[model samples]
Target chain A: MLSPAYLAVAAALLLALGPALPAFAGRPIIAGKPAPSEAAATARWLTAQNTWGFLSTISSDLSGAPFGNVVSYSDGVPGESHGIPYFYLTTLDPTARDALEDQRTSFTLSEFPLGTCGKIDPENPTCAKLTLTGKLKLVDLQSSEADLAKSALFTKHPEMKDWPKNHHFQILKLEIENIFLIDWFGGPKPISPTEYLEYGKNQALLKLS
Target chain B: MLSPAYLAVAAALLLALGPALPAFAGRPIIAGKPAPSEAAATARWLTAQNTWGFLSTISSDLSGAPFGNVVSYSDGVPGESHGIPYFYLTTLDPTARDALEDQRTSFTLSEFPLGTCGKIDPENPTCAKLTLTGKLKLVDLQSSEADLAKSALFTKHPEMKDWPKNHHFQILKLEIENIFLIDWFGGPKPISPTEYLEYGKNQALLKLS
Candidate 1:
């Protein structure tokens, strides 16, 4: 009983919504497919834009075990309010990554133009990404600790109290000695150190400012 | 001593490289300090583009526990292939993902932008993407017990190989009703029927030919 126009409208509507978007409700439409290079660049830009990264590490047991955790972090010393970075993390006695878990650990942080779950952009709702690879080292929050990570943290992220104290609060000073940013779709080139720093700064500003 | 020209070149180099990336090597730059959305997207794109995607499923034991496995996929029709979507997996073998041994599983696939690995382009890497998620299913290979799945897989990846006989090849098919796609920074969004077709098509042809 419906006209062809109706079907066309429906199809057009579907096309406009983009892939896997919520507009279709439960149905997901596959949105922008980045050509390898484009996708990779998009990923680099994402890593540059977003300041927070995930921490994937091998457990203490040395069983080749991988443990992934959502963590909050910063770029500068947690002192002298200037150039400080931090986040509100809710945890309870997370010693391994808690208030006092500064040990040698490897972490990977990445993201791409294609959006994904866990950290969907509330504003854009349709992009997907993930961290390529990086490393994370827990910064000692205690002033006496060797790492200068304490005061700078509380100043920027004042909302720390709002987070449940069940988990010890602390900061992870990022030590990205080497990261292989993969954008197989983009240009399939590794992110240069200079490029990475430039991108990281912008991302930090987004987080702090 | 550092010369003025050296400093100027350093500044120029920094500017050329952008500030996000650092100049010093073996230095860990803080990234994803707050787990921004972009980084998440990069990570997601990597998952989708690297390995072919597969659907994962779980079986319950007598007491109702869950067990699962991630089956490699090669997508496309069996004989005349357009893309490889199925995986070299094991079938009818509960031992691979039986509840007694396993409880959780992950589904992975690569999204090629244009060149290298799963990149779709040769010049840009920011756009590279990979989709990673858990939960998948199995599909009939459309072949005899002695079958090859090279033709079908993650949107027609050129790097994948055909089905392996003795290696226990099982196709990772998704429950169309429960299918979802997430970007690196973008969290899980359901894939609609419309997106399914478009992405399926894109998987076959890099561009809309």
Candidate 2:
């Protein structure tokens, strides 16, 4: 093993090289990815960590084909997740239009982009994947829930606030009814929506006990 | 600007710091991401570079709700792309089973994970997104197309070949009907399936001319 002084010198050298390399060169450390065994924790962790996922809806334009669109979403403000994904979407996009026509939808996220799945095939069970299926509902702008949703969305995606006003962006949330999480071998874990939503609360109670 | 000697020392330091850092520490340089103006090229590039994407299908298990699943897919062997995505799926998974019941499907990919988007938000049109609406069909194992697909899938995903034979993995191809590409602001670019598939050929002809 190298001495502490040697390691310090190496780290200093890396900082010196940082400006000349790519943006990811500094290699900022990411933390808080839950263990695979913590099924509810892992599922909620994925929602909080990822900024974007694929939202699928029944497409009216394609004569009932299932359409999946690349979209940005937020579970809540960073470090204070509530488990329900919220989106700022416009009907000018097909996904929002489809959701209005038919609310049945699913949102999918993968652990591959989180940089924690090191060298594993994305399809590998150990890499982790989540699919939440439910009805997509529009939030009433006047309601307190909408205020919370806007804060959750804007905090994660500052650019959304500056998007074209004429686009008629609306707030939408997934009324999650089914949760499918696969973080290890054997198959997808059986996780109810309530279990997923109340994971943090349950963990707090366990600590207090 | 720094002198050559100083830059060389910094590079040496980065190499030294590599092993102690995370998997993304080395920050492998990615290239060939086309500009937003090259809409067709950008769409094809997203398909060729990504190994997996979200495949959406109408779910029979969930009362016909649209379901999106994380899946591994390959368009072709590296550096020899055919622009038609092929998937290695097992009926044990709901995606394949749903495709059998209803062929209407769409596959979605985003350029955000390619690390070429820089600081741009994923929802920003400039970051690039592609959706291919199509029919999901299984390839007959006896056909020559299956040989090409297997070679393509194996070249990009070697672990796929080692998956258990008892899982009954089968090859499926998307029969693309429509293409939606968003690489710039304004709105989705209208790209026909024919235009997308023939882009490489058209590019070669233009180069020769």
Provide fnat values for all models in the order shown.
0.00, 0.72
- What would the TM-score be for candidate 1 when compared with the true structure? 0.33
- List model 2 lDDT by residue over B1-209, tens digit each: 44445534654565577645321122222345654456677788889888989999999889899989998888887877878999999887889999999999999999898888776788877678999999999999999999999999999988788676777899999999989898765688888888788888745422211
Q: What is the lDDT of residue B61 in candidate 1?
A: 26
Candidate 2's TM-score reads: 0.82
- Minimal lDDT window, size 10, model 2 chain A: A21-30
Off by over 4 Å in 2: A1-32, A202-209, B1-31, B202-209
Write down the C-alpha DockQ for each prediction: 0.02, 0.29
Per-residue lDDT, model 1, residue B49, is: 34
lDDT of 2 by residue, A1-209 (tens): 44445534654565577544321122222235554457888898888888999999999888998999999999887767888999999998999999998899999999999888776678867678999999999999999999999998999998787676767889999999999898765678899999999888745422211
Cα RMSD (Å) per model? 21.4, 13.3
Q: For model 2, name the residue pairs that clash.
A: none
TM-score of every candidate relative to the true structure: 0.33, 0.82
What does the interface RMSD come to for each candidate?
15.3, 11.3
